[model samples]
Target: MSKSVRLGRGVATAGILGMLVSVAVGAAQADEVVKIGEVAPITGPASYLGKDTENGARLAVEEINQKGLVIGGQNVKLELETEDDAGDPRQATQVAQKLVDDKVAAIVGHMNSGTTLPASKIYSDAGIVQISPSATNPAYTQQGFKTAYRVVATDAQQGPSLADYATRTLKVRKVAIVDDATAYGQGLANEFEKKAKADGIVVLSHDATNDKATDFRAILTRIKGEQPDAIMYGGLDATGGPFAKQAKQLGMQQKILAGDGLCADDLSKLAGDAADDVICSIAGAPLEKKGKGEVFTEHYKARFGGNPVLNSPFAYDAVYVIVEAMKRAGSTAPDKILAAMPATDYQGVLGETQFDSKGDLKHGVISLYKYVGGKQTLLDVVKQ
Candidate 1:
């Protein structure tokens, strides 16, 4: 063979090898797996809410994988790394660290305000975007962590909405307040107290309770004696249910007012007949009232064999929001996803979502509910 011809053949072979390497690299990129962490109280008293949150995220993951996800010209597969924080702040931090070690691109939970607050620092330090679907304490986002965000309104909005409903709609004159002493419960109670006092509703008494306490006879007895027209309990349905049931057992007919923690689908089962006398507020609009709410509910029921409770819709929306950020950034890196989050304006099951500078929803809604015949009945929806 001629020397020049041999050199040309060698060059052609090198060009073919380079093209093959490029194709292999593109194929590898197409198979990239993006891990998303979801932390919630999946095993403790708030398990009902936690499981709903997991199911929502799980559903979103399944649908995304099924419909196919492509980011930056590469096919991407999503994997959810779900952890149970058990509703404890300490455990939440541990779970957050685990997710960070696992190198997840983003996180969707830490359902309770207490847990979300502690876990947020871990995510922030790791440069992961942490979106809480249900944590409503104003302090959750007020901690100056750029990674922290929540889809729901804060206790600041929910508390005043509940207080206003108690004063104007329920005609409440004197009210007794009780809180579970956790960040969420106490913060909600504080906001409610501030608003209720400002609205001219006399606070007959203010008391504290623990989230795990089952017996409330002593507090109920005192509040009953005060004869307040209404009682506000700042806690979750796990404890609030029993509190209301016990109050009914004690022959107290006063209406019970509470925040989103007590506003759950399981409240009727937890409080029995006393659920009827309970008025509760959710930090977001009723799922049925949102643009894609009915469809999402039907899909959730069909997939999970039950209706969504509390923040499931929000959780599902959070997943989509994260994915939207990935698409906009054209990358699955955690920092890139976090950078895309601030500009998110995606519309999903809960409606349009946009975050403020503090990572709270730009436009928040509060929904009120009352139990009627062992079912939750919507009373009103207030915008904030």
Candidate 2:
């Protein structure tokens, strides 16, 4: 072919590619589609919780889209994008960057504190609003990030309550703590130790476990010898199940307490009949009364084909909170939503939740729950 003809062919190809690019950009601009990103465990030891969180967020988005997003009446729609961080903090940061690159309007459903903490900074710097449904570490809201928010009680409330039950109720002078060493685990453990010590309970020993650990005989044997009054665990039920069985086999049959991490019916499944005597505390009030959590339960069951795990519905509420803040700000732009979040008060799955100055939930009270007959029964509500 002639050089001029070859050059013309190349130019025509370039023109086609440019047109495709324009079409993509134009489509993005045309959609009044506001994007929300979700990062959850999805594939790791805690995938069950991840799946629940995703369903909650997806359900909220579905309702929002169906209702025709009325933010300034621009004919808005909500588009959901999800990424699996597998409950890893480093992976969570990567996913956060991906969301920022996609230019999502907001994010919800980071289920782990280890993942949520690092990802929060990325959201803060990029001016994206992020609401975590299950991150209970006190430091999560303490980080001073204007964009970070949570819908449940923090571990600061849960840990001490567990400690109180161990000390005052169970009358244990010496105790041991086993933690998974993540932000959630360690933070709650630290609180337990502090409160237990303050209440005149001696901490006999401390141990560590990873999230999916299967063996606890070694730790249980050691704790058994120490003759701790009780053992407080700081991880989720994935590890707590085996921990309970081994503790019973080792004849530690004393009080075993845990935070919200282990407060699920699945935990009862893991511990079997042995879970009956266990005393666990959750970060939020138990779904005890019919009034508060019933609507959320019914709606979630009908839509998601299952029940909300622990506080997964809190994430569903967080999604609405962010979207409502967007409506209040009259913009999906991050800075405006961030500024408007503190003023957002929405009737939600958890309760009528409002954010304090630090963007933490302030409406409902935290309570202590105990396992009995394979069910979580509310023991008491700590009024402090």
- Top lDDT model: 1
Candidate 2 local lDDT, residue 7: 98
Model 1, 276-334: lDDT tens digits are 98999999888887769999889999999998887788899999999999999999999
Q: What are the lDDT figures for the candidates, one per model?
A: 0.92, 0.82
How far off is model 2, as Cα RMSD? 8.7
Q: TM-score for all predictions?
A: 0.92, 0.89
Cα lDDT tens digits, model 2, 1-384, are 999999999999999999999766645554487899988989977888888888888888888776667676566778889999998888999999999999998899588999999999999999988998889898988989988888888877778878877877789999989998888888889999999999999898888887768888888888888988788888888888678877887767777788777878667778876687677876665664537478778878998788788766776787899898988998888788888888988876666778888877775466777777777777887743
In model 2, what are the clashing residue pairs, if there are any? none
Root-mean-square deviation (CA) per prediction:
10.8, 8.7
Candidate 1 ranges beyond 4 A from true positions: 1-30
